[model samples]
Target: MSSTTMEASAALDGFHPITRQWFTEAFPEPTRAQTLAWPAIAAGRSTLLLAPTGSGKTLAAFLVAIDRIMFGLPEPTLSENKPGVRVLYISPLKALGVDVERNLRAPLAGVRAVAQREGVPFHEPQVGVRSGDTPAAERTRLNRQPPEILITTPESLYLILTSRSRDILRDVDTVIVDEIHSLVATKRGTHLFLSLERLERLRREDDPQRRPLQRIGLSATQRPLDEVARLLGGAEADANPEQPVRPRPVEIVEAGRSKQIAVTIEVPVEDMTQLAQPVVTGSAAGAPQPASIWPAIHPRLVELIRGHRSTMIFVNSRRLAERLAAAINELAEEELALAHHGSIAKDTRLVIEDRLKLGQLPAIVATSSMELGIDMGAVDLVVQIEAPPSIASGLQR
Candidate 1:
């Protein structure tokens, strides 16, 4: 099957058989978001898709990009081995980039299968992730040998645009900004805007004859669509007299109903009595506790660890994360408790993530590290020791 034929067949039915098989295997079925968003994306239109968490919005955005890259380009001859970066995927979190890489393998495999049947020298489109934790050797290699698709966080992208390797963005044909809502209200987004402008400047300089790179913005939630459109492209996006301005369409797919979540709240039984004891008793004045009550809150953490089979506990501070883990281990019956946060070594975190994915870890006490899109399989329960400051942070948990 030629790539062109594969795309045409999929276009008639909204998704290719291979892709549909992969999707069914990785996830149960395409959500409502995927159903509506796929066509607009397949048409090569710039799009802003809005849907709630756990709605498969990420897959919706990437499937189109993968299909286009697979089908839109001509089959490469034996001599064609190198292709510059074609897709620049900007994720808000480094963890999400890793998760996206895992999710993309299935689709890539599907493309390769089709290419092989056609007797084309199927070069698997190289996908690389760049982040703060990306090893020094990989970073250096990426500069010399750019991937067909590059996944990175905004901060990493900002650093790349400002660094000597800025030229890598020159041939970028598409830019997908994942989690745009997370960046839109902060200085990070402000900095990213300038970086996009810089990228546009570079694209103009390097490929003056080519059309501007297609911009696709992905978000779980956003309001005031006009502002986001301008943020993606400048004010001149709608009114570039020289070029025809066809604004990308935005689509929203709400989950039919909220999934029923099981939540449990734990409180200290023994410590409550001590806390109720007065600071001053007759002639003896008790030593004063710290003004902040986090220490007092520590004893209540054990119930959180033992309450669920697979759990993630969000802590406000890294020190507290370690301390709570240590405390939980001391109190836990099965010795399955482990601390996970940014302060922990990267190698250790990866191991913990693996264990959690396999359901080997009974309880993994973590800060925001486990949040975002790092797949730990389906967690039976999530315990928030403290209230998340914002709804967005809470959603990630």
Candidate 2:
């Protein structure tokens, strides 16, 4: 009824009927990011959506791609009318890719339900995850029957681009990069940018008339967004030989920039300078000093865990994660918390993640592995053992 409500409703006009119905039924209204992002993406433009966490930025990038796959027409070049992947989702973390794949099931199923109820045609979208953790057999199956939406990490995407698997990506029209800040300054980011260029080349070779890939980048914290926008859109070859290449056009959507963050710094120890035990009589000068603060820290951690529904404790290394979890269990006399890090087996890590999401686990001692945009459900409390490696890392946790 209001003007803002009217604009939000108008943004959904470009989506498929089933998608719109399912979305309207599932959510009361779209987030600010979604309201601005859908229109640009629906218009086949590259988009960089900057918004705070929990602002539905992921869904803002995903829903438009899902709608296109469900109702859009297949490329004329398909040999036997078999559709290959059309949406490529790149995440810096494998866990985040897997999480996105899992999260997509609800929306896909919801849209399918809407179509079935209305007795209309519906193409069930298939989503797949390809990462180092993917088994050989699973990878083979994915190649044999490519999903409409493919989720992968930058490293995995590079591998796919180099190998024969790249053929399956010739029809991809959309690329969604998650956590753009993590990759913008790293070798991995450069590798991913080169891989995207490779992907563009592959698509052009397949069909010279096809349009350039539509890029969508999602990030919560990124400074000098102009620089990131150039990376997302890359560059385009200019028609005139006298001129240098120009940056591709991209739409920027910044929404929900102001968010409420409650931070409390708690020190359990009474004395600041006496945080460590007195120097041992026979210890060497550089010997590992025992942290007396931890003795007081453990009980406080337990009390906080018991008070909160779910908690994530982040440390800098895997060793610290193990030590913290062991200490917490030793004090609690139960397996109230588990350690999660890269060193842990993939199956075990997934079990821990699932447990935390289902409210079966009260706390997790994790390294940077858990700091990304993995949807940890109902995480009301987060404890960082020390200052994070960077501001971006701290914000991610």
User: For this target, which candidate reaches the highest lDDT against the unseen true structure?
Assistant: 2
Q: What's the TM-score of every candidate structure?
A: 0.80, 0.93
Question: For model 1, which pairs clash?
Answer: none
Q: How many angstroms is residue 170 displaced in model 1 relative to the true structure, after the best TM-score fit?
A: 1.3
Error of 1 at 221 (Å): 4.2
Clash tally, candidates in order: 0, 0
For model 2, how does the per-residue alpha-carbon lDDT over 197-276 read when each residue is reduced to its tens digit? Answer: 89998899956667899999999988678899999899877568889888888888888577667899988887778755
Off by over 4 Å in 1: 1-29, 74-82, 117-121, 207-210, 221-230, 237-257, 263-286, 290-301
